[model samples]
Target: MKNTKTPDLPLSIRAIIVAFRVFFHLGWTKISKKLGTDPTTVQKFFQCMQRLANGSEDFWYLLSHIEPSGCHHPAPLIAPGSEESLEVRKAVLKHKTWMRNNAVNYERSKANLPPLKCTTVQNICLDFKHAAANPKYPKRIKRKRQPCKTALDEEDRSNWLQYTQDLEEAEAESDILTNELANKLKDQIQKLKDTVSQQQKNAESPGTLEWELLQQKNMEICAYNDAHFTPA
Candidate 1:
């Protein structure tokens, strides 16, 4: 069997559906029979139409077949990419704006709506109402994180490894130089200590020799004085 499902359509097509429902007063089953769609789909479309008609004067104007300024502009016939098509597109957009504004004012006049209050509280209330009537927003999906990867090429990796090896070799050389310097300092310190100890021993031996020589010289001097002259 051929698929009878109702594909999503433009607002104008939906407007025609609402017109059919309103003019004929058809139930879901009868409308579904005529449209060759499921009764459930027809019912949903009707509900959507009703909500749009109730909320929008522009939709009401579409249903009522009110033309804006007694004229309609068809879509541009030129190729969309052509320079001339830009002007045609602008005209079409301007006509649409006129249609919306004129239709809204006409519907408001017919409905006898009061002047809208511009107070802060009224604006807040309107914002809240619009928010409540809004369809549920689609939830943002979190993107899966990509796995971490190294950006290093083979040349870079080899260079880094070579640098580390060179550093180790330099450190080893520095340690050898430091040990040689320490040994040299130790030998110089030992030689200085030995020289100081020898100098101290030589100074002490001179004092002992001077004492013995002075005593011998004193005995010689006393014997000379007694031999040279008698007491007068």
Candidate 2:
């Protein structure tokens, strides 16, 4: 018997279904304002479309009218020893060479800094190694020596001492800021882990059936929206 159900679908209903498929593939945000419908409603409609399309021949026929052509062809597979592979290797080598040249240029630019005394350079390197070995090791600040202020007037002596004190205070403040930032980041990570654990427990709980269903629906909506909607 001829399917009476086929003729029962109104033309307007079919048009809306096709329009929704296009909009969902293109993006829901694009048509929400034009359709005067809430984005959430459009999103739910999209999920319904997906479920219907998956199970119903009528829905599949409606969807096929809007389904894009030429999208089903498998991407061309590249064989080993192909020109494409050789070109990719060449591109990688070119990038490596460019990076090496930039590093050399950077080091050359820094070469003009005042040369460190052999003893000072050795001490700095040693301190750096110690800090790497022991996280709690204090960093040494480099201090530039000024000419003896005692040989100058009393005003010069007072100015030198003030400058040194200011330098010490600035370093202390910087260390405090670094410690505070590390602690803040650690706390944030712990909070994120706690939130994830709570969500996993909720998912596994018997009482969270509704919540899980809502999440599944939401994922379907997102998939439908991604497939149909066009970005502005």
Candidate 3:
């Protein structure tokens, strides 16, 4: 059988995929014009990209960023120490544990439960974010996500594993480099208090992109200093 597992994507490719999805919502014609491609081609390419993003880490990250605009059936604000709240907490924990061990198919589970009561607890527990926040429930420990793998020969599988490992290491190293650079800049600024004055001079210069960026940074710094260092 051919290996059918979806391949991992680098951060840059993931960002592009997210942008494509966002832009796609505007219209196919707009995307086609921007890409200088035919509408049909853009649509087909988008379908492919959507499938690729479906089960990827970036896709989950994108999902995490989504915020519900409104809740029609908002959960009632039960006092934490009250009898109703105690029962609600128990029901939430019970359903949470049940869902963890079983397929999270609500309708299928509903079939096994007594009529009318079937969806009662399920509906409340379906609000995973709220249900999972039971202060009485022990916090679930998080683990690093494992890469999805496809069936392959020993050699090919080994190579794929190595590639994923290297990809994760590269991402970690990139984050470390960013932190190191920021720290270096902070130390330099502290050691040379005149650095801000020098940057201000460069920022004042016109026409160049570097000067434009410096001016923007100076403005941001001024706003931060005003907010933090100024007296009330």
State the C-alpha lDDT per candidate.
0.52, 0.51, 0.52
lDDT of each residue in 75-162, candidate 2, tens digit only: 3543333443232223223344333233233443465533223343233323444324433333432332234333867998899999
Candidate 3 structure quality by residue, lDDT tens digits, 43-108: 544455545456443555554433233112354454434544345445444444343213223433
Name model 2 segments beyond 4 Å from true: 1-150, 213-215, 218-232
Q: In the order shown, what is each candidate's alpha-carbon RMSD?
A: 32.0, 35.9, 27.5
TM-score of each: 0.27, 0.28, 0.20
Which one wins on TM-score?
2
Candidate 1 lDDT (Cα, 0 to 1)? 0.52
TM-score of 3: 0.20
Question: On TM-score, who's better, 2 or 3?
Answer: 2
Q: Which ten residues in a row have the lowest lDDT in candidate 3?
A: 64-73
Candidate 1 Cα misplacement greater than 4 A, ranges? 1-149, 207-232
What candidate 3 gets wrong by more than 4 Å, as runs, is 1-150, 194-232
Clashing pairs in 3: none
